[model samples]
Every structure is written in C-alpha cells, then in structure tokens.
Target: MKKLLCLLLAVATVLAMSVLPAMAEGAEINMFISSPEYADAVNELIAAYKEVAPDVTINYETTQNDYPTLLKTRINAGMTPDIFSTTSGKEIADYAEYSYNFAGSPAAEAMDPAVSAMMVYGDGEIHGFALKGNYFGMLYNKAIFEEVGIEFPRTLDAFEAACEKLSEAGYQPVTTGFAEWWVFKHVMQHFLDAASDDPAALVAAFQKGEAHFKDYPVLYDNFFRFIDLCVKYGDNKPLETDLAGEDAAFGAGKAAMMTGQGAWVEADVLAIDDALQIGFAGYPVTDDPAKSQIIGGSDQALRINKDSANLDAVMDFVNWWYTSDYGKAWFCDVAGVIPPITDAKVADMQIIQQGSELSATDGAAALSICYSSDSFNQAMGEAIQAYIGGTIDKDACCAQIEAKWVELDGAAQ
Candidate 1:
C-alpha cells in the first residue's frame, strides 16, 4: 500500500510541473512609437498589463523628432521593435513588408471602423491599430471669444473679421505652429477637403501629376488668404513659434486661437488653467459655412512586426490592451484621448467633447493627409515655410510643391 501511494504522488508531481510552465510562460516585447505626448499614459498601461501578464515584460520607447528616419534605420539594421508605428493610411503600405496582418485578431475586431478603414492593406488585411483615434481642427479660448463679443466664425470673411475684432481687443488672434513640419499637414488637410468633393482622389491626382494648386480656387486663393490673416494677426515671431510656443501663448490667455493642433493639446492647455473654457471648430475654408467641417479619424497606426521572435506574446499584449475593461477605460481615464476602439467612452475633455458633437452635427471631412506619404508632406511643409518667410513667392511655392509631389509620391505609385 505504501508503494502504491508513492507512485500516485510521483504522477501528481509530474502533472504539476507541466501545468506550471503553461501558466507562467514568459516573454519580452519592445514597443517603439511616435507621439511621445502619451508616454506617461502608455507607461501606466504597461504597469497595469504587468498585473495581468506577470511574466511578460514590455520595453517601451518613443520620440517626437525624426521618428520615421530612426525607425527606418532600425529596420535596415534588422533591429525592428516587436511593435512600431507609422502614419496609418498610405504608410501602412510603406511598411507592409515588415507588418503583421492580424485581420481577425481581437484587437483588430475591437478597433473603430473609422480608424480601421485607414489600416487596410491589400485584400482587406489589417496591418495596424491605433493608440487613439484623433480629431483635427481649430482650438480657441471660449473666454476670449466671449470677451470680444463675437461668435466663433464659420466663414472665411467672418474668420478674418473675428481676427480683427480679437486683435482690436488686445488679444493675439491666432497661434500658428509653423516651426513644426507636421503642422502643415494638419492645417492643409482642411483646405484639401474643401478643394475637392473627393479629397483622396484629388490627392492621388496631384501625386500622379494630374492636379495643380493653381487649378483649385480654394487651394490657391482662400487657403492662402486664410494663412495670411493668421499671420497678419498672429504672433510677433510667427515663424519661430513651435507647438510649445503656441501652447504657451494660447494657454497664457495671450492668444485667442490655436492652429495645427487638436485634442492632444487640450490636456496641456488645461494644465495651464483648468478653468479655461476651450472651444473647437472647423477651419473657415470658403464662403460656405458647410464647407468648414471638422476632420476626424486616426492618423497614426501601431504595427506589430510579423517576424518578431516573440510574436504570440506581442499579440496577447495588444489583445488585452484593446479588449480588456481596464485597457478600454485607460484611454479616456488615464490617457485622456479619443478612444480608438468602438463603444468606448469618450474622454471628458473640452476638445474631445466638442469635436464629437461637431462631427456628429456637421459631419467630418476625411483625413486627407493620411492619403499621402509623410516624406511628401514634409517637403510640402518646407516649401510652405519658405513662402511664409518671404524667401519664395506663392507661385514658386506651388511650383516646388508640385514638382515634389511627382518626384516623391509619383515614383512610389
């Protein structure tokens, strides 16, 4: 009887050893992405994930400057992060060779359709997911507009008038972040939407060398006019103003309005003054108020490397981040971002709430900037900067931009 008991105990010990490895499988994931604005929130996410996945370790890294160039260098050196990020639409294809298409994965299924629409590769394969969906528009100080006694403008003429009124009342009318190259893409996309009923097709036409800025009155005239008004009533050092400068000016109540920024700035601006009333509206594109529609959808996409040594672990982390209760809540409660997944609660911030209301009431324009590669967008920004600095005439700017469209994007096609 004693011998029989020993045999049973040995069998139980073997079964326990087998179950322990299965339960405590360990892994490490390296996640490198842009938008360092969310670093703290992402770190919080990693901490929470540690609770659920005690054996998994995520090495998180991010940057705001020259992210694409650095990412390319890593890819070339065969040191790709387990997960990385790029712009969602056109760039998904640019990095498709290295990205995994987890089309039917839990995370992909939970994604908001508006965001997932931008992540598609060939034949409905989903190659990316977003940290947060986004909204691009003008952010203004509600207190300033109230003090000036004018409603937020919805037409180009009214916008100019509002600027004049605000200036007359001792407030800088606008804060343009002209120093950042990505700012041009944010500001130009609204004009691009107004220029064509189908902005994507129009952008594609320009890439194919079939469209010109001169051909669209909205692009050539009204958009430039709007830029001029912002400059005329803008910062004393408009060209020197980066996003931090813009935020400092606007947050200090010195500037009434901000451009080339969206929901992301709300937290920072409010951190300056929690009681500040913030207002959001579309850019004044033309004579028609309806043409001024808020633009919504994710522009940045986070992609998993298909060839990662720890692919299953990476997938599990993403799945939990997207679908779990704690993860869904973290987007709004912790990150204060527009949740990238459907049915998630919206952040209780002014820009996010207003952006949602405006998009619902007036409809949103497509995120046209996502249709072009960032390489082309960066070149376009430099040309516009030259125009702004008086080094190049408007016509010369257009010429340079058109040539670049063909030279950079056209070749890709």
Candidate 2:
C-alpha cells in the first residue's frame, strides 16, 4: 500500500510539471468591457489577437448591467484589469486615475483630432483611444418612403410634412420607445445637435452654472419642436413601446420612420427581416440646413490599466489592435462600426454606407457630450413625458431640465 501511494504521488508531480510550461507559454491579459451584446464581435477580436500573439491570451470579460458601478468597485479594490473600456469624454476623465497615458502610441497618432480632444486629460496626455463610432440619424423604411412618394426630409417643415403624409397613409409617422427613459436621452441627441454644433462650449458653461437651457432660445425652441414631433407622430402608446419591441415594430412595417436611431437599430431591424431595405437621413431640427447634422462620436473606446501585471502583453495587443489588419477587420466587419482611426477601412454594409454619406458633412458632432452625467437624462425624460401627456407645458419641461442640470452641477462641485 505504501509503495502504491508513493508511485501515485510521483505520477501526479510529473503531470503538474508537464502542464506548467504550456501555461507559461502565454501571458493572460484580463480585459473588461460593459457590453455583453458584443460577445460575438469581441470573441472574434480575441481570436484574431491570438493569431498575432499566440504568447498572449486575451481574457475578455463583459457585463451589461451597472457596469460603471462594478468597474469603479473593481478599481477601488485594486483588482484592476489589463485592459478596460471607456467612453471618449467625461467617462475617461473619471477613470483617468487608473488609466495609462497613451500619448506616444500609434493609436493616439491615428485618432481623429476631435476624438483626441475628448480623450485627452487636462494635463495634455491622451488616456484612451476611440476604436469605433456609430452615428445617430433618422432611420426610415425605404419601402415605406417609396410607397408614400416622399424623399427623406432635410428640414423641420419637410419633416412635419412627411409625418402628415405617413399618417395619411395609415401608418405611424414615427416609432419611438419613450417608455424607456434612455430612449429619450438618445433621441434628444439630434435636437441638442441642431441647437448647437459646438456643444462642448455650451456644456462647459452649463457645468460652470453660467448657462441655462431657457436662456438659449434656439435650444429652447428646438426642445418644443422635438416634443411636438413626439406627440404628433409617435405611436398611440409611445410610453408602452419598449426599444426591442420598437425595432420589431419598425421592421414589421408598422411605422414609416424612426428618429434619433443609431446603426444598431438598423442591425436589429434587419435581424427581423433580412430583405428589409432601410435608409438613413439627418433628423432635421432646424430650418437652417447648416444646423441639421448627424450625431456621432466614439461609441466604444479602449483604455489600459496603469497597474496591470501584464502591461507589456496588454500593450503589445493594443499596438496590434490599433495598427493591424485584424484590428481594422474587427471594427469594420465584426463590430459593424466605422473605425475611428484616420484612413481606416470601412465595412461594405449598406447601412454603414448610408450613415457615412450623412456623416461626411461639417455638421457631424458628438451630441451625447452635452449630457450631464448625474440623473440629467432621467429628469429630462420625466419632463418630456409630462409634456407629452399634457401634464406640463413646454416651458415647464425645459425649466425642469435646466433645474436638474444646475442641481447636478452643484452636486458635482
């Protein structure tokens, strides 16, 4: 019995020795991102990265709910990932303490200036690089538009006229998921863009408590215009329709158009009916053609953890991701995004082509930057709902947003 036990122990020790070298062949770099929906795309990227660096394993992790809270908690506990995901602006600012300064990287050199401006810290160091961008515009059913004999609207009046036409054709002019608070936040992005092309200045002023939403008549007027559109064109029970259901509704041809939609919605709609042809156009909020623009910016950006144990391996992957064909493929093909890098190749998807054509103009800007991080969207959503339901006037809704912004600004200080 004693001889048998010794032999067994020796066999186990030899098996452990054989496995250790295989494990040592690669360094496992942990990556944390928030969108579980991107699992397939992310997995494809991970596989591509493995092909380039077989010695480095990319450990990708994702969560869909309360990601920011979980990320902050992880950082606070010093359980830092090798690579982390961030948005372009204030989100990167808040995570700057744990992020590496990538000022000298190839990715930094390849970034669009506007994107760089958003990702750079106050100290003049770039903390992150935007990999891909998505645009927000009016996504319309091409077949529906053809049937109604109307072109995509380019001005507020034209938009309203088209809505009337759509309504006359026994269709909902616009499909909106106002029941979900985040939908309003995303939809209002176009209205905000039409009000000010350079919203960073306005956002800064509001942050400093020097500007009010009511003080800017263009913005104030646009707010009411948006509310009117919602009430006039939205589904009978706008508040009851959810985002997922809304996509299905649009794909099913229950509506003629969807305003303030992004590329993902196109994908969602297509998933329901592959042959459904869709078109993209700017959500016109003003009579001035110059103010009518597409809303877009860094949809997803990557940041490196400064204290990563596998910093070298992580950076090697980052360099490959930003410069290699694999990276471009991941952005252009796998993720269905327009790569944020200058001169980056774009996917041949028709929806992407339509969005790119609209984004080429001078009016394209990132409108989400103007949103205050603290409950501002929630407050605005509530106010917009009140206005839509006739519980409050337009002025009251605007005032509520202003007050919420001011209150949040104060709390931040």
Candidate 3:
C-alpha cells in the first residue's frame, strides 16, 4: 500500500509538469512601434507586465523619425517585429497582410468603440489597437489670449483679426510646425472635414481619381487663405519650424497660438511652464464656427504580427495590457493620455479635459486624416512645402497633390 501511494504521487507530479504552459520555459516578443512620446509610459507598463509574465520578455523599441521607412525596410528583410504600428484607418488595410486579426481577443474586446471602429479591416476583423484615443486641434496660450484681449478664433475672418491683435501686442500669432510632413496631415484634416459632409467618401473619390481640390473652395481657397494667414503671422522661419521649435516658441510664452498640434503637446508645454494656461480648440476652417469642430479618434494603430514567432506570448501581453487593472489605470496615471479602452478614468490634463467638454457639447469632426495613407500625406506635405518656399505656385502645388493622391492611393485600390 505504501509503495502504491508513492508511485501514484510521482505519476501525478509528472502529469502536472507536462501540462504546464509553454510560457514557463520563457519567450521573447519584439515590439517596434512609433509615437516615441509614450516610451517612458510603455517602459513602465512593460516592467509591470514582467510581474504577471515573469517568464516572457518584451523587447520594446520606438522612433519618431522616418518610422514607416524603417519598418518597411525591416519587413522586406523578413525581420518584422513581433508587434508594430501604422496609422489606424486606411493604413490598417495597407498592413493587413502582415497583421493579425484578433477580433475576438480580450484586447480587441476592451478597445473603445470609437477607437475599435478605426481598427476594423475586411469583414470586421480587428487588425490593431491604440495606446490612446487622440484629439486633434489647435493649442493656445490662454494667458496670451487674455493679455491680447481676444478669444481663440473660430472663423477665418475672426482668426485673421485675432492674429493682428496678437501680433500688435508683440506676440507671434501662431507657431506652425510646417517642417514635419505629418504636421500637414494634422492641420489639413480639419480643412478636409469642412469641405465635405462625408469626408471619408470624398477622400475615397479623390483616391479613385474622381475628385479635384479646385471643386472645393473650402479646401482650395479658404484653406490656402488660412495657411497664408498662418505663414504671414506665424514663425519668422515658417518653413523651418518643426515640433520642437513650435514647443519652444509657445512654451516660452512668445507665441499666442500653436498649430498642427493637439493634446499630446500638453505635458511638454506644461513641463516648460507648469503654470501655463493651455487652451484647446479646433482650427478656423471657414466662416462657420460649427464647421471648425475638433477632431477625435485614434490616428495611430499598434498591430500584432500574424506570424510572430511567439504569437501566443504577444497576444497574452496585449490582453493583460488591456484587461488588467494596473494596465487600464496606466493610461491616465502613467502615460497621462486619453484612455483607449472603455470605462477607464480620464487624465486630468487641460487639453484632455477641454477636449472632452468640447466633444460633449459641440461634437468632434471625423478623424479625416486616417482616410488616406501616410505615403500620400507625405507627398502632399512636400508639395505644400514647395509652395511655402515659393518654388511652386499654389496652382502647381494643387496639381501635384491631386496627381499624387491618384498615383499613390489610387494604385493601392
């Protein structure tokens, strides 16, 4: 009887060991994504995840400059990261072939509907997730606006008048981050929204070579007028001012308004002057104040490589990041970002609070920037930069943009 009991115990122990998860032996997941601003927060999240997944390692990497080009190079070399990122909407489809469709996964289920809506690809398969839902608009120094005795403008005419007031009061009216290509997409989307009731459909038509910028006065006339205004009252070197330059000008209290930025810059601006009175509002796209509504939704998407060597481990980490209590709270507490998951607490930052209030009362415009891929956006930026540099006239720039939209995006279709 004693011998039989000992043999039975040994057998049970062996069965338990055999049934243990493969994770017990350890696995490494390589995650290379963009939005380097969230690197610290992500590192913290990775550290916390280590506790739950002690045996699984996550090798994280991020970049802000030429991220797409680098990612494509790695992908072509057959060295795709276990996790990667692309813009949420049309680019989701651009990378669909390489991404996992984890529609029913816990991470996908936890995603906020507004965000998940952009992550959907063919037949409703979820191809990606976001670090945070985003709000795109203008950021202003409230103190300067008050000192200049003018409100943040909501109409093109009002914006010009306000710029005159700000400039007269010895302040740069706007710090345009025109040096970066992505900045053009951020600023152009507001004008795009004002041009059409269904901006997505309009974008598709343009991509299909069925639409022209000349047809939309709001885009060709008012939009260009606004850009001219920005350049007129903007940075001394409008074509040379990048995001950091904008941040420096605004944070130092030299600029009254900052364009081509949104909630993401709040922390950095505040860091420069912790007591800075940051104000958030949409661009003055036209004469209609209502049409200048703020844009909201996640513009960036983080995707899982469908063929990752440690696919299960990657999914496990993502699930834990979305569903776990620590993970949910990290967005607000650590990242100080708008939560991308439902039922999570919002950050107390000024831009976030103002954005939520504006979104509730005035409603936000669709995130029109996502309707097209970054490739077209980059080309458009270059053409516009040439226009700003006086190398190409406005008509020439418009012609180039329309042709490139059809050539790059239309071909993909």
Candidate 2 lowest-lDDT run of ten = 367-376
Give a tens-digit lDDT track for model 3, residues 1-413: 99999999999999999898555368999999999988999999999999998988888999999999999999999999999999999989989999999999999999988899899999999999999998999999999998878889999999999999999999999999999888888999999999999999999988888889899999899989988999999999988999999999999999999998999898788889899999999999999998878888899999999999899999999999999999999999999999999879989999999998999999988898888888899999999999999999989999999998999889656
* Per-residue alpha-carbon lDDT of candidate 2 for residues 214-279, written as tens digits (9 for 90 to 100): 777666776578657866798788777778768977989988887546777777888888888888
lDDT of 2: 0.75
* Cα lDDT tens digits for candidate 1, 147-217: 88999899999999999999999999999988888898999999999999999899989988999999999
TM-score, predicted candidate 2 vs. hidden true structure? 0.88
Write down the lDDT that model 3 would get: 0.92
Query: Distance (Å) between predicted and true CA of 193, model 2?
Result: 2.7
Ranking by TM-score: 1, 3, 2
Q: What is the lDDT, from 0 to 100, of the residue 156 in candidate 1?
A: 95
The segments of candidate 2 whose C-alpha lies over 4 angstroms from its true place after superposition are: 1-26, 361-363, 410-413
The residue-level lDDT of candidate 2 at 207 comes to 65
Q: Assess candidate 3 and give its TM-score to the true structure.
A: 0.90
TM-scores, all candidates, are: 0.91, 0.88, 0.90
Cα lDDT listed for each candidate: 0.92, 0.75, 0.92
